[model samples]
Target: MAKRRTTPKELPDAVREAVDRTVQATRGSAVQTRERAQGAVDDLVDTVDDLVKGAEGRIVRGRRAAARAIDDVRPATNEDMRELKAELRRIGRRLEAIEERLPAKRPPTTRQGAKSGSGSAKPRAARSGSSAKPRSAKRGSSAG
Candidate 1:
């Protein structure tokens, strides 16, 4: 037998409101309700997609910038390596001091997830062995 197909998802509250607004906007206007509502919904979707794309682009640029900042480039001479190491060491101490002063980071837990108490199935469980360490942290710190 063929697998049963499910109906499409119910409209979210915001989308429902958008539909209502669209309906209201088009009501007694030159355009049909469904057509104008479709246009409004399409416009909203396009706007949201643009926002997401913009954020994604910013994230990509930020990641590239951060990668560039943290990456070690080959200098002309071994003498430059010494200066680089010293600078790295200074950065390490500064980071350490900052961490010491800052609050200890805890794993995030949704209230429902915490209430469920299913430790193995939690989002934080997935992140446990993930690479969220400071760059200068030793390999030994890896949970794996």
Candidate 2:
């Protein structure tokens, strides 16, 4: 007896059509997802651009305000400084005039020994322990 070869089976038409539909649906979903993602990225980019422009505008405004503030303050501060300098100079001149009018400082007075032509005064001796003499109540009678 000779052996026979068997042929491979093909999928049914309905099953093949179902698989084809599923593939087409998946491809459509992928394209839609890509388009949505691109739109979100563009929107994000636009939002960032708006934020940057807003920040730039605020910075410009702030800089202008600061410049205006400095301008407003500069003259007043300069005038105040000038007045302070003038006042200081006037005070210095007044002090100089007072100093010139004041009496000159005198030399310190000499010690008694130096004035009397004596040698340096000697220190007193320490007293010995002794019974003190009684004091009289009437001062003039004691002196007499």
Candidate 3:
């Protein structure tokens, strides 16, 4: 129920032209902002590309370092294995030599009095030097 009629304020033509100029300037600034954003994106892409290339170079260097490290240890590792094998052989030989120098085991002595049969063998004494009997006649033959 309240429809009031208001008086219209008059706007100047110069003020309207100034407002249009301000809007045009704002549009031009928007275009410049878009161009700046595009330039920033291009710079960022270049930085990313450089980072990838640098990382690839570092990876190549790391692989080369790993290969060099393996090569550096190869000779030493082989030498260590060889030395270990040689030491094992030396220990085995020393053990064999020790066993060879061990004294021989003798059989138990027999009782001459316990044998009453005629098929019994004679008992011989242990001597260091050769006997007065010749080598052939010593055992039984006359070939000496």
Considering every candidate listed, which one attains the maximal lDDT? 3
Candidate ordering by TM-score (highest first): 2, 3, 1
TM-score, per-candidate, Cα-based = 0.30, 0.43, 0.41
What does candidate 1's lDDT look like per residue over 1-144, in tens digits?
999987556657678899999887877474576778999999999999999999999999999988887665634477878889989989977987887899977876567546565556646635687756555476457564
lDDT, candidate 3, equals 0.78
Which ranges in model 1 have alpha carbons more than 4 Å from their true place?
1-31, 72-144
**TM-score between model 1 and native:** 0.30
Candidate of highest TM-score: 2
Candidate 2 lDDT, tens digit per residue, 11-36?
A: 46677899999999999999999999
Pairs that clash in candidate 3: none
lDDT of 3 by residue, 14-110 (tens): 7789999999999999999999999999999999999999999999999999999998887667788999999997996787688779897587566
